[model samples]
Target: MDKILINVLKEVQDNDGYISEKAMKNISVKYNVPLAKLYGVATFYAMFKIEKQGEHIIEICGSPSCMLNNGQKIEDFLEKELKIEVGKTTKNKKFSLYKTSCIGCCDEAPAMLMDGKPYTNLTIEKIKKILKKY
Candidate 1:
């Protein structure tokens, strides 16, 4: 990992998963790294979540192409099955549901990314399997 990212992780970990903007600015100044560069790195990786995440982050693609392929249905299923709404974590905080735009995997419409792993052609059964792995 990059030194800056490691430090950022440490800071976030120390603060219960949130990295304040003030802290980010401090990191930039202390490390002599550009703010824009740090921001870019933070935004570039789906894994680097700027906000707090639960133990598992479930990201469902909701682009037009995906929507046409029952993406909404999948989202609904997830909500109903997991008993949580998008942007909300589960009661146990083991999982968080997030609806994203395009994941650039339209060929696998109605797909979801679970903790950075892409699971395509999602079905309730498939989702169960994925959840089991977590």
Candidate 2:
């Protein structure tokens, strides 16, 4: 039941982009789960975001391998460009920056996932161009 609960929370996040208080109440009533228990589950997992996200989700690889290959520089550049610290959504809700561990692109090192699409071998110039598209 615990595992299934996680799956259901994931479904809500997928469809709604984030878990809302109203949705949590609906889940609690529909699943016979306590609202507190549901909130605990939602907050326990980093993958479960309660607050709404920006239009573009940028997850930069923060693995050691990536860091050794200019990942930190890329992360810094992104923060500067976006003018918001990691884990924060921009004021306009256009972009959200986050640091995530290995995305299995060590060989490609210094990579990022923009809206779930892998963008590898990044450079300041490349990122600038990429951001322009969004």
Best by lDDT: 2
**Per-candidate TM vs. native?**
0.65, 0.87
lDDT of 1 by residue, 101-126 (tens): 88888998888889888889887788
Can you write out model 2's per-residue Cα lDDT over 1-134, one digit (the tens) per residue?
A: 77988999999999999999999999999999999999999998989988889999999999998999999999999999999999899999999998999999999989999999999999999999999999
User: Against the hidden true structure, what lDDT does model 1 obtain?
Assistant: 0.79
List ranges where model 2 is wrong by over 4 Å.
none
Q: List the residue pairs that clash in candidate 1.
A: none
User: Number of the top candidate by TM-score?
Assistant: 2
Off by over 4 Å in 1: 1-16, 19-52
lDDT value for model 2: 0.94
lDDT of each: 0.79, 0.94
Error of 2 at 22 (Å): 1.7
